[model samples]
Target: MADQTRRVHFVLSTHWDREWYMTFQQFRYRLVKLMDRILEGWNTGELQGPMQTDGQAVLLEDYLEVRPERRAEIEQRAREGKLVIGPWYAMPDEFLVSGESLVRNLRLGREVARQFGGTPSCAGFTCDIFGHNSQLPQIYAGFDQAAALIWRGVNTWDKRTLPWEGADGTVMPAFRFGLSGYCTYAHKVRGRPGSPESSDPDWVRRQIDDQLAWDAECTDTDAILFFDGCDHNEWDPLSYRILAERFEEESGGFEVVHTDLDAFVKEMAAQADRIQTRVVGELREPAEHSLMRDNQWLIPGVMSSRVWIKQDNAACEKLLTRHAEPLGALSNYLLNREYPSGLLNVAWRWLLKNHPHDSICGCSIDQVHEDMKFRFSQCRGIGEVITSDTLLRLAANVGEPVEADSTRVLLWNGALTPVDGSVEVTLQIPADWPTFNEFFGFELKPGFRIYDAEGN
Candidate 1:
């Protein structure tokens, strides 16, 4: 066991989720509001501070509220290497979007991480997924991630161990979550002053204790503890006070500390060899049905930070994975010359501001059309061809691979610019393999299948 006296890992994690589809004015307004809120807590000594005097603060911003103007500040932090702007995917319901849509979100999340002061070479999945599918390891591995920060269904890979391999046979990032690591939480009351939920101290403490306790059977393993950000206590003075006291009282031993996913994942990676692995499924408490339209977002699915974030940090894991291949290639292709990979960053924000389909609130069909056209136009100067991987990503997200979509393969000047020919894709489809063939045009092989859209 980790030494009890000096083993407490005090973590301070705060959520920054933004919805960007609104007018820039609204976008900026929300930005200011979020910043103010964060500042208020930090200034007031409310946030869980670093251990010594005031606890160190780690801000985990979910790209739910993204804008170009704010990008500079975020990028500055990343460049400075002080803070880690983890991953760029919109939160929640990964399945609701097309596969390409999912990857696009992943791409943007990492692009911003590079711009910001954080190194998301690894990813985080803040979500507590209904099923932490086996195939994720391959998808994530394709992006070159070492580990992930998450808490989902009881499913584990490699016969119950860390870094489970997916259907594509890729190893996943190290996974962690919670008060100890599986799922994190400070307080989330409902229907009360703090949460619209009760701020009962007894109720909250019990929840925290449950997460912090250790399991003996969890020997020689790689697992994650996710703190549930039920968020009902966002502004609850009482809960904050109790939380602060808990940290002070239990400063020694492996005490409870609220923390960001990045900080923890870094700890695991530095000692990756020691970590073990396993594969197990939830025969215990089952995951809730995906109650919301897409993951858990305010506007149903496209990209609103509100409900979407509680879905967990899965976006970060996926994003870091998605960018690894292209970034490595682009770095080599750079030959010390700047090849404008940053263009992908601009294109990323454009898409986040205008994801396909409509928001969960049900806008007019005309509103959807207007949003798409405006977004497509914004993406025009983004220079998609800079990376074959990027263009192919566009094709996959375009859906159905029609012949005319600009993203589709086209012929001009006696040369053929391939659409799906950009990047190869592979995943572990189900026994219901035909569902994939009907949609994505592929068959699930027995184990670890791969599809090279842009193959040799």
Candidate 2:
């Protein structure tokens, strides 16, 4: 027998990657099957849930895209609060994408969760990202999230619960799942923790005691959090009952309950002084090689792998932010017209799908990166069209004249003040038209030359 005050919360969650090494279609088949099993078991009283996802709304979106008929059942489960989802469109690689994109991801996630009759969990779930950035607290706080459940980038000296601070002096609770990661305490019974081969009375008592002892060493709180799932894990719907019954049999010193990150954060907050509070920002440690011992992985080099993808991603981001959005807004304001929000969203979703750590890092299978290249192409193509259309409309309204054998172009400075820049024009001449050598009185260069729009 131990102290009466000790308690433990078993968090049942899956760190779901919508697509990583596997293609989205391949994963969606498994996802549909898994959700069907989970819902059926719960409806028939075979599964107990408070199950949480990796704070991703994109998985549900992908699932609904394929199986719109099951929307009612999924929505019902979400309303019951048995299914936890969102607070993120996808679990993004923070540093690889822009800070603004991070905010938009959360915004879309929350919107999707509400559409499904579910309130997005208030916890920031950052389980699988290779590392975290300094402004994460601000981003999460902007969404009104209370805490973050993180797996990587914690030192041995750091406590399980620490205060994470952002650049703007915002602070929030952060939970690190140790070097072993989220599924640390899971037993090998049914691929989920807290389940065993034998639920015999003696085995139950021993298991509880061992767990309690291990729990004590990890944190100062009497409550222990055992994350029960891993990447792409589909839960055994009936396993929660097995854990509940076994814990009930050996109910001597502690209580066990299936809970979520939100509940755990609230419980810990009730006894705030017990959790060590220290300001933390951008954390990158316990390198990829080190995590291999614990059966976990995080490759930092993915940030630079497949340099072409990274370059394209940066160009797409710039084209949208610098050119399309500003030009669209200016056209809308001056001409009383609307920008193509639907097409813009379609383009954004395509890009965001490629933001997952493994996909963006170019560390996944060849097929996944190949698909990413295609998605990047689509994103850029859409952005370029939007920018081109907006610019054309604005130019037409400028009422510039077309002189003989020459064209007039109007270029607006999208910035606050005038900017000094160069514009290059390429001309394709017909057989009857003047040759470059004849026109310029010299031999033509191989390619187009850069010059000022003013013909300098």
Candidate 3:
């Protein structure tokens, strides 16, 4: 009863964490070697690539920072469809950052992809995020994403593919990762000297058969996806050859092809009408059938673990969106001041770098989080300076200059609607004023009083 004509799509990818157990520079060192192997494999005919860079374009940025001379080669591979990237600048945890941050992440990622002469993949690839938000389907739909490939925080009910519906009722096709997740065929395809696949010639065949059997049980689609890489994995020079040879010579009535997420998404879209299950609003079930002994539960503790990081993240986000950006744009519109788009972009990029799951989740090593603190400070500093400059400029544009001895306070609301509440303002007293004693609490000379613009 097995489907003999099924086609297996082998997606070779490495989930590159910009920083995790090691620091960013250390990880980038490994990434440089990985990229070298991948590019060399493709150039020397060792790998028939269409390798996915974990659905993030920042990895390319990281690789290029160290290997600037290889830009042309990398672009050539991307142009030739040997490299797949984007749809996210970095794979960030959904709940940790502001929703606007996620949008900018996608926009920046797509822009980076285009800069590299490659079209970003439209698949919502949530490969290793701790969990997903409810509005993700709508967000993906807004970006015209075709489908989603998910691994964690989902209960597929034994079905490999289903329709995921967002809170607002937007729906998209979603493909769930199987028991072994993205590394199902990783070890088998790139066997080490004493690994099971190398010790026994028949081991690879049996593994493939078992994988295909599991795929059969999960979904009835003719296209089966086999992810052939894992965390920080290097390019396997022989992966394509090994898979191609097995499917070619064994003649097990199956076909294997080296492909990427885009093609796989297209395959899923083709079978959309037949997909029966429809999941609604946020997948955070932590399905009990996961390959991990811990059942792949969502690590909820990360939300409050090292809470200061989250507080700083929120503070930066508010400063950027609620104050800095809005004021900058208003000043640009009304005062004819040039908008600081480039500077804002830089600020956002610094903040978004901290949004990655491991980095923002505070689950990484001390060095990683330490690096994050610096980025947060940089972002905060930019937002604060911009807000301060814009406020001063706007105040100067609207109000006349005050006397040297007089004090003038400016209160401008950045909100769209009228807000009436008790407001606190800091007053800079003249240096000549008497300082208050800690014990006696003496009153300062020339007591200040508040006044409206009409002199009330």
Candidate 4:
């Protein structure tokens, strides 16, 4: 006999990709409309509280950028926990970017959430990210995140939930989506009666029966999750009404509630001892099982699709993290100079704008990638200027003043090891020194020579 007493938590959320098949601006126009409707619904009591914003705070930033007048309204909704936002600034492809980028993404997201008088959700929500990394649990634990809700790149596991262990043995409770994935309940709200695409009134009852049967085989617990929205989906006030009225009329020994991801995590946590499955390491398998009919493709081709974007992304990451940031810190510590944090923050923001799964994975439209080039250049240009200025200041503070007639060169070793090999350096010569003749095949100009600190 089927379990008569089942508790279903319907999580309402929309996975908003900043840019994908459409340009960011084109999508933003729709986003503006979406936010307007959502806020309106909330105010009128048509839609109940607690809607997840794709687990990313960047959407809030994008929405507020256009609807500046709605800031206080958003803050009120956020403060009341009616709007669930990030533990991530953007949903990025895990394998493509550096580890430092992921850390900063979470840091920036929480910072933004607090700025708006909101408490960021601690669940590591990777609903639509291409894949996940092995150290992700460790990363989440570092941020005090309690659990993870994931969709793609989860192959091997057939159960609905498991203890996902990171590479370093840090374990966190993780919920993996079933065959229908996150949009299992989306059709219910989207296809209302009287609409052109509406289904039979009996469809809702049949769906619940089918989903509950599937959930029975997947887990022993009565608490199950059903995400009620999909990509770029708009807010619908009917979702709450439909579930409440239908479930109340039928009863059927099933209890349905509208809740956030954090509440679901807590529910699952209560049953942790019963969950025996342990999935360790990264989750990047392309599911080939028959049961996973709606399984998402890993789409490994995105890694190499637009090679130039990857190249530009790597160059900018190195410039900001390895060069600019370290040099700035050194100047602050050694020379007693204040760090240029504002400049570095701007550079990081521009770079992170390019880290979204679609943007960085090179799976977005041509116009999207073209716009990414501008953001990359902005981050790189800022990093280069900071590196140059910091180096000049450090050189001036460390060495003795050079003679007026002599030229001096300072070498900076950014690496941790000592430098013992021959190094090549570039010198700036006075414009009057010499000009190479175009007619001459190869001409050597007499330039300044280099010397060690001892004038060897």
Candidate 5:
């Protein structure tokens, strides 16, 4: 990952967000329509030169949005080291993408990557949460990715003023931008709300000129990421190549290149002792028993969010925690191959991305009824959960407390058992309850309480 002179990097971070595309049946319609469009474009060969590489439509899987057979085809491409529309998970934000759900997403994404030919080392947020967290060194390490870019944190930095991390460990690539300045060009532009079909080459060229002027005028380094429109659906092979073509026709001798975003980090890593690190982590302190404070965003860093987003993310985290067990069961069942592959595929696709039948959200009349039956089959039919719960109950019996003693108290706290656990406790619990879910039925002694923790 050493630096090459005048690096021209190209990266395509693609994603799909459509209302009707989550359900199975509707997805079918989308798939057919898109497939027809691609095939037609292929036949006409309207796609030429770099367009073949850039213009080629990719089905980015924030969720595995396809049928099993199509997934197989993608896998085939992956095995051959071909990069055809990789990444197949919803990428539910990593910090709180539910451990079980994240695990499942990774497992499924891995399968899809294997079938396609290239394991997707790079991940795309499409502008959800902010920052490339330090905790994610392990995440990228897991996916064989050395780094990722934060499209959101373009000019936001502190201290070093280059693309350096703040007090938190949010990494951005600002120095690279400073060196390049605005070698790229464009024109005849009008800025809209957020770049919705307005900026012509003239406008872009003007921006480039301003960038050049800014570059010449400034003595110290000023950082800026050239590519705009990170959150919107502006970045595709079509738009990128169009820009490239413009540069080719207009920029005369300036070189343009394409590279995966990670390439930037890897290249930078070669020169310095370490790529500068910092990002916003804890903006506010977590006061005792205060949920709001625990998740607040105070410090400005790479993933800086207005108050609203942090609150929404916190809420999502709570929801994920509340449903951890069922989530774990779903993951384990799928990983263990507890049922037929197709049935598991149907279930997770429904949960994570789109439906297996037609490729949309919410089942059709036919699918809804069928899905109700299928879910029951996936959950209850396999009996993994039921059997596992039964084992938990039986196993606790052998480890019974050695004759309840005043000195050797079993430390009775909250519910001795949750539905997800083997042990259950009585109706009422003691003073020092260790927070847990209570279920029906239980037996308790006069002084001794039954209520215990979830896995009690």
Candidate 6:
């Protein structure tokens, strides 16, 4: 109250889910069209952008997949810091995936962002995730990420910003924009920027003043945030341009800035001493703010909506982690065989594509789930092939013992400890056994034959 009218940082962002109601390619094509214009604005200096594009590196891969021609332009935008992306391969459901998978997701995101002369946004932008895990502070801090921008799963009492403490005692700034989510400001504005109602300077001033005053009560810091875009929103250069100009002209004592998550976090952190800090870890927050709930309607019924999809997803995860990756690594280490890293990366990406909160939560449309099934099939197929091939290569080197009409197949347990369990062996006319089929005093079925371990 003693100082100036707080600085309002307008963060423009689009929460682009790679696939939710539609297929990945379908959504990606629209993203390409959106980026084309957003980048064009950057190149022409028409839009002063710090527009955040959903913090997922996978979108860049998606955009480049269809429009390889615009690689240079896109790279330039990234270099210029006009387009902020990554810190995640895909915005994942924290509860669904393994902790290791989350680490890999962030690692790949940082790597991808580095390729285009831009670092991943320093803020962990978990804007739309249903909730967050406690380990996130440690994970984000591992990558040197300084803060988190959260929308969902925020406690109204926390007042949007909290000092998120990890299991390891690592602390990071966490900003929460709740109630109406990240695009609350955009919703408050009447129609498009050029509309008669939206163009009024006095009206715009009142809205800003009211929002700032309301937000001011929520925190001790003089910095307030206004997110300018919504879900799957296209980058409207004209609207942003008009608003940017209007805010500058009639900010009503507040310093208006078009910023990204990183800059905003830094600004907030700079005045960290003045702002209240609540040490937090797991941020499921109150049930009231849960995206899984909307008033009396419990929306997270989708968690159990499609049991079969979840079952298949579990199977695929086990196949990749327990079998495929281990076998591939062993084969590369022991046999000097080329590890199928590319195949594994493709498989992991396919898996991550379905890890979006809506997609993996089974809350999407039938068509989207159908596409997810296809992606799951592709990932599982590749993983199976890698595991089977590695097993075959390793098995080939084992010595076989001969016993009369039967052949002994030696089993090599890949694990370090001695295995004392029953093993299923497929007999295919053992090395020394001359006969194709033999029964162990049991009747042979029409299509099945039983062979004794000992030749008879």
If ranked by TM-score, best first, what sequence of candidates would result? 3, 4, 2, 6, 1, 5
Off by over 4 Å in 4: 1-6, 156-158, 187-201, 246-250, 290-292, 416-418, 431-444
Query: Candidate 2 lDDT, tens digit per residue, 6-48?
Result: 5567777677776676887888888887777777878887666
Off by over 4 Å in 5: 1-5, 18-88, 123-127, 130-134, 151-201, 204-242, 246-254, 262-265, 272-277, 280-456
Candidate 6, overall lDDT?
0.73
Query: Measured by TM-score, how close is model 6 to the native structure?
Result: 0.84
Steric clash pairs (candidate 3): none
User: What TM-score would candidate 1 get against the native?
Assistant: 0.51
TM-score per candidate: 0.51, 0.85, 0.92, 0.91, 0.48, 0.84
Q: Candidate 3: RMSD over Cα atoms?
A: 3.1
lDDT of 4 at 453: 79
Better of 1 and 4 by TM-score: 4
Residues 141-199, model 1: lDDT tens digits = 55555565444444331121255555555555445332222212443221234452346
Candidate 4 lDDT, 1-456, residue by residue in tens: 245666677788888899999999999999999999888888887786588888889888899999899999999988999988888988788888999999999999888888888888887898887788999999999988878888778764458888898999998988887665666556543555466544444565566567766765676455677777677887655445656564423256667777888787777767777677778889887867664465667788888889998899989998988789999999999988888899999998899989998999999889999999999999999999999988888776656787766666668776658889999867777655544544674865655555777777
**Model 5: ten consecutive residues of lowest lDDT:** 48-57
Clashes of 6: 1
Name the better of 1 and 6 by lDDT.
6
For model 6, the superposed segments whose C-alpha errors exceed 4 Å read: 1-6, 190-202, 236-239, 246-253, 277-279, 289-298, 399-456
lDDT of 4 at 289: 66
As a whole number from 0 to 100, the lDDT of residue 55 in candidate 2 is 86
Candidate 2: 10-residue stretch with minimal lDDT: 445-454
lDDT tens per residue, model 3, 1-456: 344566677788898888989999999989999988888777787676588889899999888988999999889878877878789998889998889999999999888888898888887888887778998888888888899887678766467788888999988898877655665556544556446555454665566677667776677566778887688987654445556675433256667777888888888788788788778887887557634422356787888888999999999998999899999999999999999998999998999899999999999999899899899999999999999999888877665576575566778776668878998877777776444445666744445566666556
Supply every candidate's count of residue pairs whose N, Cα or C atoms clash at under 3 angstroms.
Answer: 83, 1, 0, 0, 62, 1
Window of ten residues with lowest summed lDDT in model 1? 50-59
